[model samples]
Target: MSLSLIDAENTLASPVCALAGRAALRLALTILWHPQAQRIGEQFIAAAGSGDIDVNRFAPLFGGLAGNAQALGHRRIARDALRLRRHRDHGVSLLPPQSRMRVELNGAMLAGAPVRCTPEQVDAGLVIGLGGVVLLCVHWMDRLPQASAIAAVHGVGSAAIRVRELIRQVAATDLPVLLLGEAGSGKELAAQAIHQASARCRGPMVTVNLATLSETQAVAELFGADTGALARVGGGTLFLDKIGTAPQAVQAQLLRVLKTGEYRPVGARADQAARARLIGASDHDLHDGSFNQSLLRRLEALVVRLPPLRERRCDIGVLALHFMQAWSTRTGSAPELPLAFISQLCNYDWPGNVRQLGKVVQRALSAAQAGQPLAFDALVPGVAERTARVRLGQLSGQAVLDALEANGWLIRNAALALGVSRPSMYKLIGKHPAIRQIGQIAPAEIAAALAAHGGDTGRCAAALRTPSEALRRYLRRQAAGKLL
Candidate 1:
């Protein structure tokens, strides 16, 4: 209906014309401008000759009195002032003149406000005002490799595709990326994909899991007592994993650095600029009152939420086969992953996410190595029992009501019967609005049981052999709350 598609109809005879014409139209769309600007854009495009672009190169149009400009051979991209060259790992950077290059990121000034430049870079969708014409800064990674890799890791699900697309969209900019997901949901893989696809791929991605750090003092080992960690990264990416576990002191330090790009080491007296691009990952919802709100705001320049495994079950087989094939290649020979076995995996409610899937795959490989056949039972050693436990775990609204009744509205004993902890027992009590026991249970008996179990509902729940969460929920229907 629009101009480009109508033009495409005129070139139906030649395959090459269709392709080439479409590409030109795409380029034209990308450089849209108004009356005066359109004239300049046309002059710019004619001088630049087609404005055909490559992922690895950029060509400059105008030059100042100091020097003549040269183009990088990887791709012929249009621009007025900046010539960026892509390296295999370090990403792209300005080719010449060695002058300060300032970038306006969606509005914020990124580089030229006295911040020294580096080889590592990232850009999301950036609008650039070049001379009298306008342009968009495409993210450094638009190729298929990043897309295919994400699919292999996450799956073929629409969720995976959307996440991959998000990664591609943001990988090129200097924006801080925040990844939120359940444990083992491949947040790290997503971060890696961003780094690999960005202009910063050439630089090292230094990863530090705050949860794994022993204590506040551990910051010195990674961040240093002097001004060094971020400086050392020098245009690379610094990944902060499990950011929720950061000690208050560490949190304070992170807040300072991320806010102003000025950080002092654990013992350093002076503040220095951080050159490393930051990427933070957490399984927890960072905005919850528990974590520092200020830190969350600074770290979450761009937030990406990953769908848990249960939400994307279709990806299970794709990932399973991918893992099997990769392992087969690694070991030179491995058993084929049967469709039946793959289907068995797809049916699971993977609480542990992709991490659990990889572990299951590894276990399957081990079983095959020992001459054991791959099957549901072989791979899932206690599949039947786990299934039984899950069944028991799923007792419905009525079951919760009945359990409370049998336990005589005593939150403690009811939890015990349901194999749940006291706190869990109390929660179960709350969920049953009609099952109030505020005065029903004898005080003396409640006291006696609390004294007997030392007030440990977990101990009581264990004796009953029931999951705490289910009982906790139904009992809580009387109240219905608590962080799960």
Candidate 2:
């Protein structure tokens, strides 16, 4: 009995080597991050040489290390290890017998043996064994960041890691921060993270929704009638939600404050020095000419774009688990989340993003009966159908082209718009006779489009009906003299 390990890069390691390496990595992560390190260490020692791979033979060595780390009171390490362990357990329970699993670095299962288990059965970060066949899906455990650092921003995917790094980078600066993302996509969370990480952490963090305030009340609410948000947020952070919806007057006032670090309160004769660090968030495209350019420019000095939940599908499992843990802690009811339900969550295109997902998790937990796995489909009608992968065969070439053009030739966005997976969208584009890839377009044509669009890659992409990224690559190669 041997294990098959296919990593994100599609690299396959020898069965014995893969098992040994994976076990070592999981153990190391457990020691550094699991809360029940002592117990997990004991289990690791006990399970040595128990499975067909007999990879656990090295567990005792690593398990002892976890015990020592736990005894030293490293809470962060224990928490992360516990997260990885849960993910691995979930993944294994969904694995099919005698099937190779192709997994992404973020713990997303790309491909699994359909004969043994349907695509619906596969999950993220798994491990399971049946009759000498053991499937380990703990490869992502090694990539887990320090749990304490990210805190409220829960995710284990590469996208999440990038967001965390960006937060860390921007927190060191005092520039006005702009957060861009869809509604319910955690823009507020990103803003909170920035506030928590900044030097103003000790000061009050104030949040105001510009959209909720009327045009007449905007000035009074933001700057106040002698004493408002600006004064209230003194030396702290002022987070403006839906800044895109702000009226022209408010925008002018904000721009003045950003430029001169001074703003006059409503009905005030003199201007006061602004001490609060400003953070603006919006779901709308600020460049759409609705927002003031000066204000947008100032706010965007340190911008952080939060990826939508659909774009970070790999993080769905861990996020769901986080929500579940929170719900359980609040209600004292630990309802089980079925692998099938988690798979459904991963597959679904969450238009409302993380906030929406959290609500779904809450609803499921509330409706769940004792000792039964979460019935996601029952909680949300047509969820299974909506989440099911859309086959390319079901769509017309015209439909694909329409989706592509509508989304500015962005593959991922077009896929989401069409309710199809990215891969399926790619296949649809490839098969369409009207749609052309960057490679198929003549360099001269691209050059002309670039000129017509005034060197704007986005405009050129729309004009040429190709992906902006691919067009950029072509331009880069041409500039490097790699393409004629």
Candidate 3:
């Protein structure tokens, strides 16, 4: 479908919009890197009343940087930026530092390299932000199909990055691919990505959910009497979702096609050549003798196992932000997400994986007021308590101490790292002899820590293993006493 035809109200939530936002951000960053970048910013600020660009066609993309610039009375800057984008190659090159960092991000994402940039670095402008990096990486990796078959799969963690690398590697070949993952773990997305990245991307993609087809219906639906999926997906991709659920007879037929590159229709006298590349996905372990082992062996030529959402908790923040933006586009009202609620999201054991988390985010938005914090407990009901209980059960006294030290004694941060609530972290600390509460800390110790850290409250808090706010309050009381 043409992104230009999509309603402006809904485009922000669409994959097209997400891609456009990335493009706009990259363009803005590039302009910032240009030697005449300051002039461009001034021009955008100067031209506050230039005629609007086609909001219907270019708005989703230009609207990101251009629209924002216009809102700030810089219509000329927006217009110039758009013009520059149309002829971006004119002498523009990213600075060496930014270019090297971008290259590192690409390698980390598509080659499974260990390179990473912390948020601090991104904020300091030492490198592009993670969102920008990921978008550029995907754009480079996917190589721009006329239209993407699916939304860009979003992940930043090592597991997700490895999966992206595998998809890129496997897409270069025509061998059958097997996707193994829990339900809603993005197997279908992976299949689509493979098809879009493959040589057969120009062709059609036909999907058959085997779980929905019975034995009697499988042959007719798949191999068709006149023209089945194989016939319809000529020189393209045929994705069989829930492959483990395929009937025994259908499994044999699929094996024949995979092995000999041919398949017979339900009642055809002769077999036909199968040209479509096959991609099979399943949540089941097919090695238990129930599934066709021979067929399994054939489909396993390239295996990609999608990790569950819980295993990649590091990606939860970015994923949540994506879902929230989608929600905002759909509803036209941006809801604020509190840090505690985000911690709650990371701590919860999402049994249903990424799909479940997305649904919960939508529900939370629906239930929250325009100005209120999104209540995690109201929507999820006991998730916080259950998560806290589970996390506390797993932690010993020494484990709590180790977590606190590892996080530089930031209770909230340490709590999040250990998948427990702040209160639970304090409770665990109370039970540990090695750990001391702010109240238990002597004034002399606090004074000594402050002196050692050159009177930096933050450093003193870390050194004393106490909360900064409490330390600040204690110092305030001491100052008052000296004044009296």
lDDT, candidate 3, 247-349, per-residue tens: 9999999999999999987788988899999999999899999999999999999999998886655456557777877877887875665534544565466
The sequence of per-residue lDDT tens digits that candidate 2 reaches over residues 1-484 is 1111112342222123244654433221112122331222111211212121122312222323123311223221111111112223222212222323222212133223211211122222223211121122232333323223646676654457668878988898999999999999998888899899989999999999998999878888888855589989899999999999999999999999999999988888988999999999999889989789988888889989998986665466567767877887887865665544554565566878999888988877766644445666766677645554333445667667665665557665555445456676677777777777898888899889989989998778988888766888888887889645
RMSD of each: 25.7, 16.8, 13.9
Cα error, residue 153 of model 3, in Å, equals: 1.9
- Give the range where candidate 3 is weakest over 10 consecutive residues by summed lDDT: 136-145
Question: Which candidate leads the pack in lDDT?
Answer: 2
Give the TM-scores of the predictions, in the order they appear.
0.50, 0.57, 0.53
Q: Candidate 2 has what TM-score?
A: 0.57
Lowest lDDT block of 10, candidate 1? 40-49
Backbone clashes (count) for model 3: 3
Decoy 3 TM-score against native: 0.53
What would the TM-score be for candidate 1 when compared with the true structure?
0.50
Q: In model 3, which regions exceed 4 Å deviation?
A: 1-151, 369-373, 385-484
Candidate 1, superposed: residue stretches over 4 Å from native: 1-152, 225-228, 375-378, 388-484
